[model samples]
Target: MDLPVGHIVTVLEEMGIFEDDSEPPFEHWLVGRLEGLAPGIRSEAERWTRVLRDGGPRSLPRREGTVWLSLNQVCLALLEWSNRYDHLREVTRDDVLAHVKTLHGHQRRDQPVALRSLFTWAKRQGVIFRNLTSRIKVGQNEYAVLQPLLPEQVERSVAAALTPAARLVLAAVRAARVAQIAVLVLDDVDLGNRRLIIAGRARPLDDLTLKLLADRLPTGDAGGRAPRTSTTPTRPAVPATTGSARRCKDRTPPLERLRVDRQLEETLTHGPDPLHLAEVFGLDEKTAMRYADSARALLEQDAESGFSRDTRQGGNE
Candidate 1:
């Protein structure tokens, strides 16, 4: 449970809690004292969190708000997880690794690094027995896995949409992801060839899909104003400036519905080649390949299931 600093301060002030020759009131209250964090460990984690809040990571300093809160959130969560343990020596490397994986599905880069840095600092401060961070490694993020959709799902998702995004999502399965789809300019659409040239790669757009895009194509994109730039299809950097620290993202239509279909298409048609995926999706080869591998895995699973079903049917017959 998070004890609010203001609430605690008010109660202490009202009750006339004062510093004595032996008991320090302000020093004790200022630090978040709880049963979970051991004495030295608690002070170190709390102090590091305060340091991050003031500036940035000790290793990589850019802005204050960008990295501090997330890193501190991870730090706080770690402290909370330690429970009644007196020292970080009780928290194993595996324990910290598992905690890192749970952060937004382990799809981020900085938070894990930040957590590792905390552990390193703890080790240097003699709070922990060893630097557990040396054992933990954060991997590259994987985007959405493409799964082949049944015909009915495609029809229903398209029918459910009020905007052109659903049809685009369906087309994206063969071509790219939503960001790539969003970047499509009118000049890129080759209706005559029934395909679009994206990143110098020709991806076929069927006539019906072409007509759908034509109907909903933004005038800005058509007039060569360029599509709005979107963050890469992974967790992005936190905004440094003060605002809500979060944005209210408006839903972009049947896109939500069409993602699975799109990825499946990318897999079945394009296979799991990261370079090709990068060209199509406008992602770095590594990120693109991650998606490709996921698609390939889904395809392999589907194939295995189909083989098992056929074998069972043959046995029954």
Candidate 2:
């Protein structure tokens, strides 16, 4: 028994976790803005752990962020399903199919991927004879719909301080992706020569984009050639003592993930490969595909507008 049910129940009860049992865990997690997860879910201590840890060759692949976040959702679903059906061993294909169908379409793709890995492992352990997850289908990649705003309009929407616009502009104009843009330091920008060097390759920059970067970028050198090596730590500021926890919450906004509109970022992210943008930006493949599609749509719209302008000018002549 990986779980000590009494301790788990105590913590959840203290946190006022799920007074209503009607809601799905996914919706509850998002709606209640759950910042913490049960130790069983966070650690390798769930009932699924045996196969997950010891299924050597058939082990599920690990992923980060939204992809791996699917695990918590899956664990919650399994717990609920087991309770309703009397045990995990009693679950069938219909139970999984019915549960999966309730998911938002995008999650229907991602979460099923998580569950399929688990179910496959379970089948090898004689929990299920066949991989019942085989027939579940998810929708394909979708493009971000272009907003009615122009490039400048979209750019202005971002905080001048955060510089998402500058990030987007440089990536788009240089035929680069977000990872390349994010790694860029003052040394990468050659304002005097109108060039941006990335990984020893000199990419020519237009005056406007260069000016945008110049205004926002903090230079390390008097000659603007020194590299900036400083990086913000990934962890949030933790309270040092029990007394400071309230101070921490007061000083920082409680729900501050900075969820800015990425429409402009999507429109600007350009590359030949769909996965390239995703790899660069630490985004999922579906998001990367959408960004590429938005970029293409923007380019097509520009070309059409340019052609129309030419036609109107010729008619006037």
Candidate 3:
């Protein structure tokens, strides 16, 4: 009748006929012709025939990498996923949540971090189907089928792995890659002009944050310390400063924009120093200072028009 593709592939492999070139002679053909094989076996035979006809290493053999997951968790995920979506052609969000629940076991009481790791592992293994509704909603609550690391999560992870100074160096390197900053060099940052010439390579990134980080890069040999190079030259820089402005402009009602603008005003009126803001926003101090300057300028305008106090007094005459 029918057979699972895995079992058929196994049988064919054992017989050394998975590839047509590896197929035996007339006797093999006679056996197959006389005793019609299952659909899975026939399908594999057709595939082997095409591979032999084309004959150019149709597929590269799978390689084993050192990365491993616990055998127990993997099996659990697989079983749960397959069992949930057997009738359907593809897995859905419910399938994923079901699988994650099983993988988490009693850990449901404590949100499971391993859920992402397990899904990534399954994707790498090519066992669970991909592009199967990466999002699913139940009742009023919605959950991503496979949520990746958030911007804050990435920053936290990177920060925990590196020192405060190293964090600064890494931000510049990433800024260069993402075209947020042109080049990160040992010299002064070119803000208004937007360019830098480091080591040998040159690039063009139009990011205010990178422009500022470039300014913070250490210069000269006078300090008596060896010059250190940025280590992370290819990480992605999340949109931080201009994101709010763009969102504000694009929003329909513009209330979001006003809210963002108000928050900006509050930060300027009473907030941490520029250096701390730079670190918090993953920006260079120079850029942070520029933002501070802009904030102070806005405050001045507000005071000059009496908008600052008037707004605080509920626009009273």
Using lDDT as the measure, the top candidate is 1
Q: Return model 2's CA RMSD, one decimal.
A: 12.6
Q: Which pairs in model 1 have colliding backbones?
A: 173-262
TM-score-better candidate, 1 vs 2: 2
RMSD per candidate (Å) reads 13.7, 12.6, 19.7
- Worst ten in a row by lDDT for model 3: 63-72
Clashing pairs in 3: 179-205, 180-207
lDDT of 3 by residue, 1-317 (tens): 67667778899999988964556453364344423334433333333333333333333322122111222223344344444343222546666576445433334422233334334433444545663424432222222221112234333433342333433333343333323322333333333344433334332323423433444444424442214455343322222323323333333323232222322333454552576444433446655665566566656766788765334322110
Give per-residue CA lDDT, model 1, range 1-317, as digits (tens): 68767668788878899433555452454354433566756666666655554544444443555434545446555666666466656777777777666766444566677777677767666777888778566765546664444555545545554444444444443455444554555456555555666667776664335555555544334343223346332221111111211111222224433443444355456677777756655667665666777767766786987743233222211
Judged by whole-model lDDT over C-alpha atoms, candidate 2 comes out at: 0.48
Candidate 3: lDDT of 165?
42
Q: What's model 2's lDDT at 109?
A: 71
The regions of model 2 sitting more than 4 angstroms off are: 1-68, 124-127, 147-209, 215-224, 227-288, 299-317
Alpha-carbon shift of residue 168 in model 3 (angstroms): 5.2
Ranking under lDDT, best-scoring first? 1, 2, 3
- How do all the candidates rank in terms of TM-score, highest first? 2, 1, 3
